[model samples]
Target: MTELLLVATGLRKSYGQTAALDNADFSIRPGEVVAVMGPSGSGKSTLLHCLAGIVRPDGGQVRYRHRELSEMSDAERSALRRDEFGFVFQFGQLVPELTCVENVALPLRLNGVKRKEAERRATEWLDRLEVTEVSAKRPGEVSGGQGQRVAVARALVTGPRVVFADEPTGALDSLNGERVMELLTAAARDTRAAVVLVTHEARVAAYSDREVVVRDGRARDLEHAA
Candidate 1:
């Protein structure tokens, strides 16, 4: 079996009196798309955040490629996120001022890649995502599906080892959502990057290689469940 690229065990987090996660465990291998499925407020997003190092767990540990997220300093965690992880949110979240290509290139530029080179790669990703026509348009000028595709391009331009997508298709209609999932999963597979996809929709989850169901603050990896 392929070695696990990320693992979280006994994870616990709470908001005041409410527990977001209770001893949740998750694992993903390289090049795999693992759907984290659950209804709203089921802690699926919380699990994704903890795995991506965006939010630290109140208890337990998250390990990525042999390094512990909780043990890393804030700067270290930030650096790790910038270099090794990518994220896509429900809203696409592109900067309205920058063109789509620029948005896609932002992560590379942050990593010190030069302007021309960064945009060249960014344009390439946009083409691959089938949103090349919107390259020169700002986020606000494009359709929702196009904007989301640009977001996916941005997430992949950094060539991150893992991508954390929380409700990636939530803002779009079914047709657009299906197209986005197809492109996202295909691109991820081609790059051999693991994906942590959080969604409540079964149709979206069908794109994944494995499923982990989160319900009432607990996670159950269906593939490993008895």
Candidate 2:
């Protein structure tokens, strides 16, 4: 069996009277791609945020390598997020002023890598994602697909253990979305990183090795649901 890299047990969260997660249990193995699918407001994004340590659950625990995230200090959790996780969002979220290579190198720079070395590594990822031609272009200067490819390159440049993507291809057309999923999964696989993908589209979820469906603040394995 593959080693488990992340686990969430009996997670619970709420915003006022609305529950975002209710006793949710989920796990991810190293190098596995797991998709979270559900209707909007069903708490899929909340689950992803909890798993990524961006938001602490009101109850239960999120463990990464046996260390409970809820027990960590804010600074410790922040460091863990920066060192161990990557993220891709629907809008790509690349800096408007930074060129493609610069955007990709930002994470490495945050981790204390020298600019020259970071750019070199960033260029390699850009080439891998087939966005090398856009290396000198700013985010606003490129097509949506090209910008997204650059975002993927950025997310993986730091060699994180996990990638948490929320509707990563939501803003793209079918053809572009397909291409992004292919590259994202391929890159994560190549780097031996687990991916927790949150998407509403079945076509996007199909890229994952396993699927979990969220409904009414609960999550269940798709296979188990059948």
Candidate 3:
């Protein structure tokens, strides 16, 4: 088996009186792409949040490599999130003032990487995603698909062990959605990074190695295909 990059056992979460995640179990191996599927209010986003260490879990364990992130202090978990996990949301969320390459290099720069080197790495990843042509364009200057591609590049430039993407293709039409899924799956396989993506679309889930359906705050049926 590939090295285990992340593990969540008996994962649980709650929002005031509502239970978001109820004793969910999850595991991701390096180079694996896991798609999480669920209808709205099924706790898919909460699970992703807990896995990314953005929100604290009510109970259970979440480990990134050998580190038990679930029990870490806020500052400690924040550092772990910065160094180990990458995130891509439904929207690109890029800074309109910065060019695509600059936005892609942001995380690397925040990690104290030199600007020139960071941009260099950013260009490489962007090219891999086939968005190098728009490297100089700002987010507002590009199409929705293009901007989302830039966001994917930005997420990967940091070389994180795991990437958590929530509805990454939700804003795109079918053609662009398929294109984005291709890029995401390719990135996971090529970089040996575990990818946990949340989507309700079967087409999106088809791009992953495995899909876990979320229901009633827990993982239910699962499907797997290479």
Best by lDDT: 1
Candidate 2 C-alpha lDDT tens digits along 171-207: 9999999999999999999899999999999999999
TM-score of 2: 0.96
Off by over 4 Å in 3: 221-226
| Candidate 1: stretches off by over 4 Å | 222-226
Q: Write the per-residue lDDT of candidate 1 for residues 63-167, one digit (tens) a residue.
A: 999999989999999999999999899994899999999999999999999999999999999999999999999999999999999999999999999999999
Per-candidate TM-scores read 0.98, 0.96, 0.94
Candidate models: Cα lDDT each: 0.93, 0.92, 0.87
TM-score of 1: 0.98
lDDT of 3 at 99: 93
Clashes of 3: 0
- lDDT accuracy of residue 175 in candidate 1: 99
lDDT of the structure predicted as candidate 2: 0.92
lDDT of 1: 0.93
lDDT of 3 by residue, 32-56 (tens): 8999998999999998998899988
Query: Candidate 3's error at 134, in angstroms?
Result: 1.6
